[model samples]
Target: MIPLAMLAQFRALHHHLLRLIDGLDDAEYRRQYHPDLSPAGWHLGHCLWVENHWLRAVVLGDDRTTRHDARYYQPQYSPKPERGARLPPRDAQLATVAAGFEANILLLADQDQRLDPTHPLMTDHYLPLFLLQHHSQHLETLRMVMTQRALSRHRHAFHPQARLRATPVAHETVSLEAGDYPIGGAAPKAFDNELAAGNARLEDDTIALRPVSNAEYLGFIESGGYDNPALWDALGRAWLDDHPVEAPDHWRRDGRGWWYGIGLEGPHELEPRAAVHGINLHEARAFARWAGAHLPHEFSWETLARQGRLSLAGQAWEWCDNAFFPYAGFKPFPYLEYSTPWFDGTHYTLRGASRYTPAHTRRPSFRNFHTADKRHIFAGLRLAF
Candidate 1:
């Protein structure tokens, strides 16, 4: 049965998402802020599409709503760069999402108590939870895209005096004894990629209690970390060929100090103690090399997290040392597009969540994977070994 509280939460989340795009103009809503991001309109429609399809179409066999253009909604059919062109007008997209939400709410009234034992929604008991999580993931993406748009629209215009500053704090590394530690797939709501929870035999190692900070990364910048070929791997160097090797996304220099921006917050002076926000795996790896440390493996991260030794939750996603791949006896979920398509060894696994990450979806087992060169996400690194 769908609990009343759960239903209320669902309504609240929908409202929150609506407010996120409440003031976006037509151009801003439809703008593809980056090659990696879809337009805001596309995400709004896609979120509704999944809820409508899974709840009404798949579960109730009641796909009365007209289907969206497959070319715009399907990831494989539409690449990221071309999605803006495929998206409908901003107002039409908003109306479509609103309609889907209303339909989904009505469907929720027929609680699972009436569902047959073998029904798809019943068999996959977490479908509602999954839908909520799916929306949360896309909401994070939308938030990032929106943040990028904000930064681009108001670069260096923010006043330094009006901006707030974060006080510097010292961080410590904690030691864990050698043992077999379990990682991923432990949580009931874990995604398919985190399934087949496996044990990792870890040697005695030390890991940072918190994520690496902007001040720490600045040392890497000053030391010619980008120019030093020894610190960067071949792929990292290759990635730098086309992109600026120095400075992370959202960061800029003004004479002697640095400033960074995110979302609608405008820009602020670089916070020495705050976790660095926008470094990709390659960049994280290079920074680790410069510090004479290494990125923690997923297991090590989980071990620290399980022990409650880890800090800085819901701040920055931490990069793992391992490449993204399926575990032994892995099985794809009903949604085939989630993980199986990305197991081509091109993406590295990242663990944990950022400040903008939704509270309900923050799970230690949640494995986030992206290409090595992608840096727009709120990703940072923690030192291991």
Candidate 2:
């Protein structure tokens, strides 16, 4: 039987995720914030599907849901733009969510002795913890989607006055005497992507003490950094030509000046000291180029992460130059779909935890990745020279 403590934690995570959607109406709930991101309703249903897949089906050998709604929720079937059309009615989706949780609770109560010891959840009795982390990740995505929609449609949703934010300190480039450093760590709860610990021989390079702030990024924007083709790589320039983006995705403008967009918290006048996020890798690379700096490699950033040089506790993730490639000796975990599909050299690696990152999964070895052009996630930039 799952311990009461573990069951309580799972229930708490599920409740917290549902709470994110508590106040929204039907229209708001179904809105797709971006072309790439799933709707809130889909997120809710997907979480239930995932929990049922792992905790109930895989762990307890219950496969009842496979025939009815599982295919609808599969990643292949529920691509972002199509999710809203593909999903069930809002009431039905919510009911599925409730039923999924109830099934999970029953599964936890089964106390099945035939469970596989090698199962991911059973490996260290961290099944519930893993589910909690998964829920946390999706919840953050939902928040981002909601905040972006709020900024675009309802500016009034945000508080008028500025909320307190992280100010950028006087950042200096500090040099690391690099050598063969062991990369990744043995965090018991670490994801499959962080496994197969490897070593890298890094060159001695100077790295930023913190991420680039709005003030620093403003200089680039005001100087026509977006228009200059020389500052960007060919692919980036091509992307710019097609998209013609003027600023970071999170930055909004008024008759006065550009302001930063904080989802749910409302838009605040740009704070010079606050770290600039919601920027894509191309923008980050362009900024680095304009400043005669370079984005840090994943290994170099991990050095800082290892040393605890920066305040990573609640900071947004920093973009790295490394693409999401597997380590030298790599093997897929129980779920091959998690990390295998993304290693196509299109998505770049993002290092460090975000404000929404769960404390339990936060580690120097943790690696997050996304397509280089995507900027909706909690992502920012840091420099290395």
Candidate 3:
């Protein structure tokens, strides 16, 4: 059980989500994206179900509230039906979700912080925060899905969906004995996911740690950086070809003008020093290669994470070259079905949570991923040498 205050916050959160989905109608809910992501309708329902399942069935007594579809909710299988087969209509979906919400919140009321303790849902201290982050992530996904559904005219409406998305991640910087120092967070550990190797020197030395800023990447753009194939990997080059990406997805410069983007700040002139967000690992890798730099290993991020430096964790995801895989000694704990199927080396790892990531989901130990080819969500990169 989470604190009562947080439970209230969660309740309010659900309301906000409902508001975010305000105008979409029944026909719009069942629409699907390629086979990987869920349809907006089922996605929203399942999002509600996940929390309900944990609190109602798994956490509190097996308070089986609404029937949860094991086939659809199982996180193990990829390429599953978009949130499962079509539904009984949008009204039914909303009512079912509403019923689940009422029961789930009661279970969380005045609850123990360590509600279930051993449950993967309970052990994570940051679960609530991750849940908040995750909700925003899906909200963005839904927004994009709707926009791509030929509703480009409605794009203006989606910008505000991510407004309250800043989450706090702890960071710090510490030096290591240089020379190929061991990198990466606890193997399969999640990004919250760098460092330079100078060769063994004094331990506990200090170093500078910062999220990659927009100005740094803007310089890459101003210099015709993407034109050089040397800066791109084969896949990155292919992606560039297929997409014809001039710069960041929402970026534009008019008449030697200052940079601008569609972000929480609305359409403000781009700040170069702000972390260069919304780029996927592939783009980050290409950018680093072009600049003769390297993406820091988990070691650097963990060091920086320890330093409590930049406000990462909840603001946006930090790209790392690592792929999401279990540790050598990984044992299936609370959610075997969730992480195992993704282990076939199909996705790239990212450290830290973006404002859109669920608060329950963001943790230094939490590793999130997508294919290197993806750049749709709010992801950014931190450079290292």
Candidate 4:
């Protein structure tokens, strides 16, 4: 069961996300960083969409309640037929978020006596609890977008890819023994204890020294890698049906040439050796299948990471086939609302640290995971037989 304190943490997170949007205007709200990112106003509204969808609709079993009201607020590109204000003005959206926040606190109060431990919502903190974690995450994206737009004039100077080129990779294959590994973050402050108690584990399964480069990934694409049904699973085929993927995320063709945003330069030429990132697990798994291989499991990846043999802690974070789950004999940390809830599902695991990962965040034992469809983040994958 989640402690009262952890529930409080979730409530606090609600306010924090609300604060990021404390003073948004119509122009600012409509700003779109990328098509994948829901506009700020949409994101703000989605924070409530789940609460209403899950709590009032799913949790309370009030099936008649219309959840599409939340969708109306979704600032997506499918076109809002009822244009102008997609949201219930600013106050209504804010009120929804506020009400959702307060309702979560009430959920926590009765959680000890009336809540179902096995409920899917509780499994990952139910809808109400998950909202806090969910919103906190989007806040980071919204904040970055706001900062970028506010400083649009300086965009040319601050791009990550603009500063670096496709440099040669220094590290080589690193390896670790294979086993089940816990994936994702520790408690807010558990890293200190993880180190102090020697609970964290690092493995060194041989990992590629560099990211799967663009040229190599493109080779997969050119081979009709996306079309080969044999290369995909049931769900993967479904994804391919709706989404025509080529190369990686944020990529497009300009006349005879193809390019992508490497965090700068307005779509520079694609590099061949700099790890094929931005491809989702469906794409990665499909490519692996064509190559007579499959994605590496977390234990396999961790084995590579712990060996300290590869420089992945610097160049990039690598993906593995394993889903993120708690380790054997693992118990919930202070804010039990975090990782445990995601264990039962199809969350994909990744290893090593990215440049964005803090030095202290680096660990062979650390497990990171996301849904197979996610590609907007700093993620890439490695292949193994």
Top candidate on TM-score is 1
lDDT of 4 by residue, 1-385 (tens): 5678767776666776677566776655655655445566666666666555665666566644345464464444235333334545666667777886676567666654556657665565544434554565566556544534443423332223332233332235545554444433344433221322223354444455545666666667667877788889998899888887765664555433445444322335455556556678888788777766666776655545555555434445577787776665566543454566667778877776554443334667666677888766556666664
What's the lDDT of the predicted structure labeled candidate 3? 0.58
| C-alpha RMSD for every candidate | 2.7, 3.0, 7.3, 9.4
- Which window of ten consecutive residues has the lowest lDDT sum in model 1? 162-171
Which residue runs does candidate 4 get wrong by more than 4 Å? 1-26, 29-172, 175-206, 262-266, 313-316, 355-360
Candidate 3, 1-385: lDDT as tens digits? 4666777777876775665454667766665643545666766776786776665666665645535465465445424464535454887877777766665666555354436656665555345544555565666566555434442332432322121221222133334444333333331123222111122222333332666567677667666767878888888888888877777755644443444666433344555456767676767887777656667655456555644654444566787766776654455534555556667776877777765555545545456768876665667876665
> What is the TM-score of candidate 1?
0.92
Q: Per-residue lDDT tens digits of candidate 2, residues 173-202? A: 677785888887664566778878878898
The per-candidate count of clashes, in order, stands at: 0, 2, 49, 30
Write model 1 residue lDDT over 1-385, tens digit each, in one string.
Answer: 6667767777877877777776798888888988889888888888887787776667767666536454567678778877777777778877778877876766675654443446755554477778788888888998888878877787454435433243332347899899888876753377888888888788988998888887788778777888898888888888887786577887765544545555555666666777887889889999888777898887778778877788885688889998898987678886787899899989898888988888777877788898888888998889875
In terms of lDDT, the best-performing candidate is 1
Give TM per candidate: 0.92, 0.90, 0.71, 0.55
- Order of candidates by lDDT, top first? 1, 2, 3, 4
Q: Which 10 consecutive residues of model 2 have the lowest summed lDDT?
A: 160-169
